[model samples]
Target: MQLSIYSDKNYLPKGMEPVPMLYPFWTEFIPSEKYPWSRLYGKYLEISNSLFKMTSLQEADLVVMPINWRVIRGESWRSKINKEVESLSIEFAEKVANSGKELIIFFAGDCCVEEIPVKNATVFRMAVYRSKRKQNDIIMPSFTEDFVKEYLGGQMSLRHKSEKPVVGFCGLAVKDSWEKKLKTVLFHGAMLTKSLELGVSPYKGQILRSQALEVLAESPSLVNTNFIIKDKTVFLNTQDVEQRQKARAEYVKNIVESDYILSCRGSANYSIRLYEILSCGRIPIFIDTDCVLPDESIIDWKKYCVWIDEKEIPHIAEKVAEFHDNISDQEFLDLQHECRKLWKSRLSAEGFYTNFHHHFSRK
Candidate 1:
């Protein structure tokens, strides 16, 4: 199905092809109008003044909107200023939905995309690594489900499971300062330096994505770190930090070689890796400080996994040793089996995508 994504010219779905994109984020790294299935904003949809002007909505089957992906620069809860950008985008989305074309928003699982009114649109969430919404419009089409199915059951369709543990992240890296109203950016290098000071170099803390791949590619014993802070309620990733692509690569490689992966998060938001790890067939060592999941969620969690208190991290080495010696191979495989079953029933990519596809088609 041709999905026309209406996002800034810079927000290209990396490696996303075949799915048609009507607009692109204008950026240097991403070539505009040159790539197939993606194009400049002017080529299809146009948005300004809380309005959207477009001619192709009638013919298009669906609209994949990366809406609310840019709220980082515009609002702060403590600041007097409201989230102007989010307000504008929400308005624009309403218009598109009212146009009779089913709009599918690529909302972050953990962001405020929920603020947008869905009167007519069917919001579809694609979690790269983490999702924040307690109840997303739907949770299918997860890379977890796709990854398992592709390797386990061969299909001829264009879609296949995404590679496990991609180095993608969704969180705030910077925020608009309250005093200056000027956005303060976090540099990646700064965060890495801080991680080093903590004596847990990000390079060593549960490495993922590219790092995990390398580790898995080499062996199944790579150590990767997961990060989560108690609910600050911001959607942007840790900011003002400089992105060192090489370091990220090395980090992911480390995880790829390890048998266990770290799944960490804070306050109401679980680590995005929870879904990723279960789907990828890796043992996840969950780090939870105090939050206890519900009986159903807990049964589900225990049916396939392990959990440790955040405070125990200091003694993680001993804990790891204990678990290694005590856990039976059958127990481990049972965890994998239940985890995969949960993924299929509750978090498969195909299930959600099909719902999204049908929703758009009906309208």
Candidate 2:
């Protein structure tokens, strides 16, 4: 089915595309010849240009809020939206509401505003708790570059079944400093004061990550672990170009070399690494913390990953070993290929938007 979209040009943020979330579709990028991460964000998949038609408001199926909700500059736990942008958004929403149309708002970052002021809008967010998910709040997948196709030139690093599965992780697990730990404590405390409906966790993402890694690492007989744990979240924060590139290469290498990549939530409620693991045609040992994934209704996400609940974290190693022992070597390889295909068809930036219109139609 074809979907037509419309957005008020006046509401779009200055120097930004009409639909920033679908950047690769309308914008041209100069290929980065140097760093691997530099080449990571652009043009991983090419889709038919006719999937979505940009049209006039009266002819459009959906109204888009050209203002990117996630890009508004804000402070940690206290970011404020731009007054001018806010006024324009409300004005645009009022117009759409009067026209009797539903607005599609894209919020892509780790942290989103506590709420969107508009009522007749569908908010797609990357970091949302399944329990707290509203009818209009659709849990969207974190867009990722295709590692196997983009980095490996379409050559998948498929693994054969062995006595033990190789589980890997390379990112922030523990808080690096006392200051950070204190901040986590303050944040956790603040969350406790909020409504229980928010799905607040006493343990921060880093603490939970460290606990899972420690449990897996402790059980050497059950699984073979290949971890590069760091105290600080360096991949995004590191300003050094050389260091960032090296970290990116290592992160990709860890996923490719392992059969099962430990995918857990970072600062956000969802894990970007989970998508990366799928992009590389590897199984993810997904640790579910009352999380919702994109297109969960259509996709049997359990088939792609070794699903683990938050309470089952301590038994992660045994779970991995059991999952590995059950699948035949050929089944294992087939799963890897299926994962890559899933990402290419539904999880990639181009792929998601190509099939995303059906999501609204079902509503």
lDDT of 1 by residue, 7-122 (tens): 33323334432122223223334345553223212223232212222235566555555433323222222222235544655665776667776566544333322244445555
Off by over 4 Å in 2: 16-18, 21-48, 73-78, 175-181, 188-203
- TM-score per candidate, in order? 0.41, 0.89
Give the residue spans of candidate 1 off by over 4 A: 1-63, 66-68, 71-88, 97-101, 117-136, 139-246, 253-258, 266-281, 287-304, 307-327, 330-363
**How many clashing residue pairs are found in candidate 1?**
63
Alpha carbon lDDT of each predicted model = 0.39, 0.76
Measured with C-alpha atoms, the lDDT of residue 105 in candidate 2 is 87
Candidate 2: Cα lDDT at 195: 29
Q: After superposition, how far is residue 244 of candidate 1 from its true place, in Å?
A: 3.4
Error of 2 at 143 (Å): 1.2
Where's the lowest-lDDT run of ten residues in candidate 1?
196-205
